[model samples]
Target: MSTMRDVARVAGVSAKTVSRVMNNDRYVSDDVRARVLQAVDELQYVPNVMARSFRSGQDAAIGVAVPAVTGFFGYVVEAVERIARDRGVAMYLTCLGEDPDGEQAAVEALLARNVVGLLLAPVADDQSYLKPWRERTSMVFLDRRPRKLSAAYVVHDDNGGTRLAITHLLDHGHRRIAFAGDSITVPTTARRRTTYELTLFDGGVGMDPFLVSWGAHRVPVVPRLLALPDPPTAIFSANPSCSMPIVRQLHAAGRSEIVVLGFGDFPMADALTPPVSVVEQDPTELGNQAAQRLFRRIDEPDKRLPRQVVLPVTLVRRGCCQRARMGPAA
Candidate 1:
């Protein structure tokens, strides 16, 4: 275990100089900094993270809480981790994995570990559990905002993006565009469902409650919808997990005539028989921007009011929705 004293002795500098270099103080001359770093590398010295934080009265590390380390949230985690690295900030990553109790526990554990701030993609319906730590910790919500709690956050334009997808279908003469998604109680799902309905109504298309399906078993839902006497001419899936399964099921059922568009892009989405068209939200930007906001709050706790940032989205048309009406009926 190499210590700061060891590095200082090897570099022929006082321990105080080594401490200054570790803190990244501008007062340390460039020549001294180089020697200290070289000595640190050669000695394989690692600083005590908690001790460093205690000495500075703040942790340079920030904690990130997400649903999981894959899919949409995975991209966000990568982006946040990259941005944190570039900014010379440490990161503590935790995945809550669809459990409300786990979400609360992750936050508590991050706080207990003394992270300076948190970037959270919340799962809990009510975040009053975090109220006690609000004063001491700086947190920025990502993907979804906390219910009944005021905090800084970054989210995509859910309504606008879904509207774009529905409108694109409408332009292609899709009269009945079915929507497949998960439980609407989730904030993102709720916003997307609301937008899908509102778009249909605003486009002068009649809204049929039967056209909407909710659950993880969207593969079965699609077949039932297709069985309807007045089946949808096109379908809009609101999230990535729902999107991929819907496409696979439709393809397997030999129902390629039914057009499918989705809310997020996936691997090989463009490689399908007819590549999938999608409403693309920038997950990287979502994570990067959320982390940037969290860092700012950590640096200047009282500098600004809580903010809500909505990143823009675009509808990426690959071969999926290219053709005009071959008559509206499927």
Candidate 2:
């Protein structure tokens, strides 16, 4: 209810002085700042953020766009929110689902709010559309890099992680290994799938197209994969969404012989009957680094920072990937 003008009147200072004091301007003397603070407290004055943003041409908040606020992405959101709270800034979040077509519109909606910075986990392959807004807003890509647009990004080493998982399986003597994922269109899935094939090829076991399964949360692929004449001895799940369902299906069918290695760790992974092993990627760290890069961009709009940051991943061995049992031929 109380406005800056009211505080200024009570503090016996001009509205401009009140504004400077509220913004922590160093030019205002200590006595005047104290008087303004006392008046603000007495009147319960709350500065309107929207008004301030309108006057300054940018909001004191940041925007985040992700596929969904669940699983690994949920952890990223929590981390970013923590940093935003610590910085005394607000965050606006939007879930773009799995559709790449909707990505541009959703991002534009956030930009329309005049957000000072944006942290995006983009689904679209090409992000050249964001080029026009680059001058006004600080944009940092998270988890995936932009294709056409060169910008600051923080992402996991998908190729290295996938190699680690596939090599682990190969070390355990899993020659007949399969790849399970959401969709090949996704950048992360594509990278992991490529690495999975390359690692298998390098290990002297060429890729088997029939062994790869991908769709939108479809679990029936598991049964189909098992029904093959030559079933895979191991499967490399590209993400947690694919990992959980495949693990569930295998557990229900009592197919403990088929090994599974996931790309990202999830809850209940260690509690499964044959605890799932994974190439561990820290979503919290990814989010933290991405948020930090975004703030850096906001602070130094003209300074040239590194274009990309690739964080390393580690493999967590567990009960799933065991030495292959000798088949009848062997």
Candidate 3:
């Protein structure tokens, strides 16, 4: 309940002098600054950030809008928070749960908070609604780029990584390969699926349309993929959510011999029976890069034009994807 006037009274200084000390004005004498700070500590005074922002026409916090608070985006949020802390800026986080309406509401709430910038992994198919705020807020997209906005973005090379995975399987003589992922409407999923088909063509293997499965929920179709007349010798699971289910399905059916190369590396991936190999993209690095770029844009909005960065992905060799071409054991 302590106010600036209380601190000023306790420090025997004018209200303007106390305000100068609180704002770290260089003109305040050392003696006055020390007394004002001591009075602030003794009174447990908390400055109102809203009031400060209103007066200065600036906000010290950045908003982070993500699809969810779990999985790969969870790691991204953690890294963004770490960098924001290191740079002494507040991060206001919101999760949309993969819904377009929720994404719009979350972003509007952040804008209402007077956030200086936005770091978003948007779910909306179109983001043209943000055009009005574009002139006022610095924004940097994460994981996926915005469809209608020309903002800075940081994303993984999903297509290239898919090629790496399929190429590995092809090298291991897996001509009959299956692809599993989320809906093709997702930008990453579409790119990965396209790459999967292109890789098969380049390897001189015929693409099987029946082997590719995608939808809003593709986990249930995993079991069906294995039941086909000509089941795949290997499967390339594109997203993190799709990977674990396929692994479990294979284990449940005692079909662990079938090769699996997942896109995103998960925790305990190395601890599983026939540890899951993966095309690894560092979510932490991706988030850190996004936050750093956002801050740079906030500081030099006009000096630096929008930059889109795509981080590389690598394949991790593990037992699951190491199956060699051979007949079933007698």
Candidate 4:
């Protein structure tokens, strides 16, 4: 069998350099690395990944599945690519089209491809759809997490971000605050809504069940919210996707006083008339970290550490989300 020793000798480099080259780790000079790779190709030396898995396998491929190609989704995929490049791992990119069947097919497709690990932005919060491949692959979730899920995950401090947002509105002297967006079916939406309401209650405001808005999905329901006789003083939309409809309705109704803060960052959120305030999603970092964690899990599947990585995000105030037309400072 061909060996690292033979490659190291042929490339005039040490076996450790061969390993570094194999893993795509840093610290090797480009010239020496090139020679090592050339030697690998010439020797027809395929790394024994399955054997490595059994004893010393080090596969250099990861499968990354995202729900869409929007700004946030694309950012996550880019970050995964970067991390893979840095680590000498190859990334197989899949867009799941943001649905359950699509997400399932993506994971199944990756498993069939013999991908070493998976980094997923799940389409939904159920695993029965993914259980078929769960045992065969290592998976980590991004942006949204699933119920009864066993995989390690990376996500925003969603509840804390919502609390910060609601507190900002309260400080802006908004009494009739409306939580508009998110379906109870989506855990992230439900969690943020609950936190927003709790923050209001904690601040001594009675919860107005009428002021809370929700639906079965993330479709546009802004027109309904705004047309109410007693519309909200300030609005908090949890997703950037939800903000567009909110903005369009407000513009149509000539209701600029209705302040809004979006949860996920988007391109035009800053360019709009009242540059929408946003809680930076930072999915790039999330995907990168989740990939790293999944690789670590692959390397030491029985490692005695339960890993949970949380990235920090800031509430960027712009547009109407800034201090809502500040009153005279007395």
Candidate 5:
């Protein structure tokens, strides 16, 4: 309950001097700073961040918006929280669902709180509505690029990673490979799906529209794909959200013979019966880099133009997707 005025009274210094000392202002003499510190310790004073934000017309907080908090996005949120805590800043997080209207509403709610910056994993196809707020808020896109808004972003190399996964399957002689993932409306999934088709075409494998499943996150598509007259020999899961459920379904159906290559690694991926091969994208690195970029923009808004950073991914082969040829299920 001890305020700056209480510390100033105890330290025999003016409130302004207390404020300067609290802010680590160099103009205050060493002796005066020492007195303020002693009084602060004596009174157990804690700075009111909310009051400070109100007075300065800025929030000492940032916002993070993502599709869901589970799986890969959870790791991203954890990393961003760590960075915010380390920097002595508060974080306000929201889940912006697949709806474009919901995405806009959630983001606008964060902005209404006067958050200094935002780290968004946007699901909306168009973000032109965020144009007006660009001048006042430091925005950084994570995991996916903004559609119409040009802003700083840190994302995985979705194209390269998808190609790597598809090529791995092709090298394993999986000509009939299926692509399972969220809707192509999602920018990341769209990029991955495009790369998946291109890689298959270049590898002399024709695209099978029947094998590609969108909205695999919400619906069980693997079983339907397996029931096809010409079932896929291998399946390329585009993201962890889709990957985990597909793997679970395969396990439940006792279809360990089918090969699977997930785009993002997930928890217990190596513990499954056939395990799981993955094109590993570092969510932690993505979150850390995006949060750092937002902080940089928040601190130095005019230092430079917004830049885009694409992090590389690697293939982590475990148990599945290693077959030399497609054969009858075991």
Candidate 6:
């Protein structure tokens, strides 16, 4: 148990300066801070986090309850973990598996650990679990936000990202464009579906019920759409996860004429046969922003402002977005 006095003596600084360096007070000068750290390391001195917490009253851990690691949520979680590591915050990652009950359970468990904050993608629209613990912890929702919870959040503009992909297809002279998404139960898919339909309607393209196909949350509707009398010239699968079934269906149907665009960037965007073109969400930036926002909230909880940050997305065009005038199938 090397005391602050030992560190101060070796570093030639006051005991008060040692305390400032340990607590990251940011008031100490650069040179003194460096020497203090070197001395502490040379002495193999470990600060008592429990004692520090008793004095500072901070647990220094955040609870992040993520939805299943299937599609966009999975990518978002990965980026957030990196930010967590850089911030030196302990992140307790739990999978909700898209289950409302499971999400509730996870939240309860994290709260019990005296977690200072929470980053969540609200699984259920009904935030019954949040009512009691809302004040105890600062909660930030990621990806999909709940309707009623008025707390701070970080989410991609689902409407804007989808609009970019759809607009690209429309601009490429593909009038009979179609959309494939999982059912409207999921908030993310539902928002994207709205964007796709509204974009077509705004462009004077009549709504084609036949062109819209739905599937299970994990399933793809490629086969059903391809079976239609007039298949779409361009297709926008809801997200990259949906791309697998769509591409697989295209190969199985032996149809290569239709152009395809995926919602989010694919890991192997360039390696695919046609190379996937996508509207990419910067989740790394999102995570960094989330951490920045969370710490700010923890540092100043009494502040009346609720900061909601929406990150921008970019469309990466590739060969897959190209299209040509196609004759009806034989």
lDDT of 4 by residue, 176-268 (tens): 788777566566777888998899998888778777777512555556666667667777887876766777777777876678787887767
Clashes of each: 0, 0, 0, 5, 0, 0
What would the per-residue lDDT of candidate 5 be over residues 9-105, giving only the tens digit for each residue? 9999998898678756779999999999999999988654434455558688998999989778989999999878866789999998778768988
Decreasing lDDT order of the candidates: 2, 5, 1, 3, 6, 4
- Per-residue alpha-carbon lDDT of model 3 for 38-70, expressed as tens digits? 998999976544333454486878899987888
On residues 203-293, what C-alpha lDDT tens digit does candidate 1 reach at each position? 9998899999988434467778878878887889888888888888888788777788988898889898788899998898898899878
Candidate 6 Cα errors over 4 Å, as ranges: 1-58, 70-75, 328-330
* Each model's lDDT: 0.83, 0.87, 0.82, 0.73, 0.85, 0.74
lDDT of 3: 0.82
- Which candidate's lDDT is highest? 2
lDDT value, residue 178 of candidate 3:
92
Worst 10 residues of 5 by lDDT: 47-56
Which clashing pairs does model 1 show? none
Evaluate model 5: give its lDDT. 0.85
Give the lowest summed-lDDT range of ten residues in model 3.
Answer: 47-56
Cα lDDT of model 6 by residue, 51-144, tens digit: 3334446576778887666566666667767655554567777777656656677778887787777888777666655778877677777777
Q: 236, model 5: CA deviation in Å?
A: 0.4
Model 2 weakest lDDT span, ten residues long: 46-55
- Please give the TM-score that candidate 4 achieves against the real structure: 0.77
User: What's model 6's TM-score?
Assistant: 0.80
TM-score of each: 0.81, 0.83, 0.80, 0.77, 0.82, 0.80
Off by more than 4 A, model 2: 1-56, 326-330
Global lDDT of model 4 = 0.73
